[model samples]
Target: MNTMVWKVDKYVDNLENNPQVVDAANFLRKNEVVALPTETVYGLGGNAESDEAVAKIYVAKGRPGDNPLIIHIAEREQLKQFAAEVPALAETLMDAFWPGPLTIIFKRKEGVLSEKATAGLATVAVRMPDHPVALALLKSCGLPIAAPSANSSGKPSPTKAEHVLDDLNGKIAGVLDGGVTGVGVESTVVDCTEMIPVILRPGGVTKEQLEAVVGEVREDAALTDEAAQPKAPGMKYRHYAPNAPLFMVSGTAGFLQRLVEEKRSEGLRVGLLTTEENVSGYDADLVLACGRRGELETVAAALYDTLRRFNQENVDIIFSEIFPNTGVGHAIMNRLQKAAGNKLISE
Candidate 1:
């Protein structure tokens, strides 16, 4: 099928008042897929209550049916229509961080939301996006939108409209351009349906931030080799990867340097993504200096763009430094490891 790409101007200041957004929302109401920008990332959106619209999202991205999508709403009031029961803890957390980068899972109301949107699961992940374009689209449509990152399954999530066009250009109906996403990562997903809050995915909102709201939040168990099914989006798959082979560098700086040298000495064109300080003394064909060692937020923001750049350069192999395990770093490293696919531990 030939995809239709709409190049809407970036909605920067007043999204709620944008006429282009109203048109995008109307398009979604008609059971069509629209790529809309969000604070976390761009999402391929469809009406959550419409099975036909939700199915279009799955087909557009080639996403697996078992991997559920996140639903975006304009306000907290919309939650009542979808959730069967909203816990007290969820309410407290919502008061503190609603209209932001946090998604809460709750028991779904039978007839209110389409089961296809949740991949036949009884639970639904929902959030109120902070981006002006997202909120504007939701408000104008007057319905909850089920969406996932605007890219093909197992590929890098799109932070800019161009990335969406690259992956979904001919696959979707239209794209409402908002400038680059500020958070530049997916939303933090917490399962409030459980007795103790379980974090299904770490993203724009950190574990520390969730802990402060819910008092005690635990990370979901790692996917077992035997049971590799993903409970949420971006889990249980080799996602956010570029075309070239990627490696996550671990251990000392010397070890990374040696690995790069070894790969280069083998006559392979290597690409290195590391801090500005680590860029020196590397003989790699392409080197992308991200930022300071501890400043992982920068790396998180630049990850996909850097990978896309390497792919454009036609590098044989890509070596990315492992980010420190904290805040957004955890999520960044998670994606890096998955992109690497096979692990190669250097002695």
Candidate 2:
């Protein structure tokens, strides 16, 4: 299959009718997949209403069929077609963060979205991306596009077009290169089918932000319970991992530095993933400073690529300092913990 790669602008230039955009949208209409940029991350997209189309996405990414995919829409009015009933909280959140990076799971309208897209469940995950290219693609395609992270399953999500090509160059139809995505992660998933909203996954949207609108929001227990069934995309697998083993340590900078040195003395090539403030404190063979302390958004942006870099350098093991559990920090730690496969050590 010839994978078409096209460069798109941040804003549309008659995008709905652009030949290149049309070609990409045409590919999607024919029950094929396209990797398109969103504010959060690149998604390998297929028409949500078609089983064959959604099936192609899972095959391309080697994603588990049981793990649900998020459907992307062009506007809020599209919700009525897919959802059985949109709750009051869903309306409030849509008003607050649609065309951004928030995903809300709602009860499905019978025979609406394909069963394959919903993972045989009664609910479906959906979001409207903020990127012009993404909105243009969805609008041109004229259908809800069910997409999962474009990377091969259980690996890091793509925040750039190059990252999509790195993992899935020929596996799908094409990629719409809208340059580097802004949020650098996936959407925050809120399950609104219940009486009270429960967060299945944390991403670009923070819990505090959700609470501000909904009054009170709870997190899914499946995030930490290994024996439990996964309710969202990232919870079921060892995701966002690189080739090298990653370990998370919760201790003072001194303790982290000593641990790296101890590993180095054992003839192991160690990689330290730390903050900018403590970059000089680490004595590892390789150090990747994610970002400054207290700026969790910056840290989120660099975390995945840093893991990929350690792989390129062929480090034996990587050590990372954990982040705070509030705001965007929660999402950062969630990805790192999955990348490390929950291999955490305390003070």
Clashing pairs in 2: none
Q: Which tens-of-lDDT digit does each residue in 1-347 have in candidate 1?
A: 45445445554666655778777878898999999988888999999999999999999999888888899999888888989999998898889888899999999988888788998888989999887678878988898999999998888888888888888887888988877887777888989997888888778888888887678888777532315445665576788887878888777777877888898899998898887777785668898886567677877777777777787899998887777778888777777777788454654
* TM-score, per-candidate, Cα-based: 0.93, 0.96
On TM-score, the leading prediction is 2
Tell me how many clashing residue pairs each candidate has. Answer: 1, 0
Q: What digit string (tens of lDDT, one per residue) describes model 2 on residues 4-104?
A: 89888867678878777888999999999999998888999999999999888988899888888999999889999989999888999999998799999
TM-score of model number 1: 0.93
**Which ten-residue region of model 2 has the weakest summed lDDT?**
225-234
In terms of lDDT, the poorest run of 10 residues in model 1 is 222-231
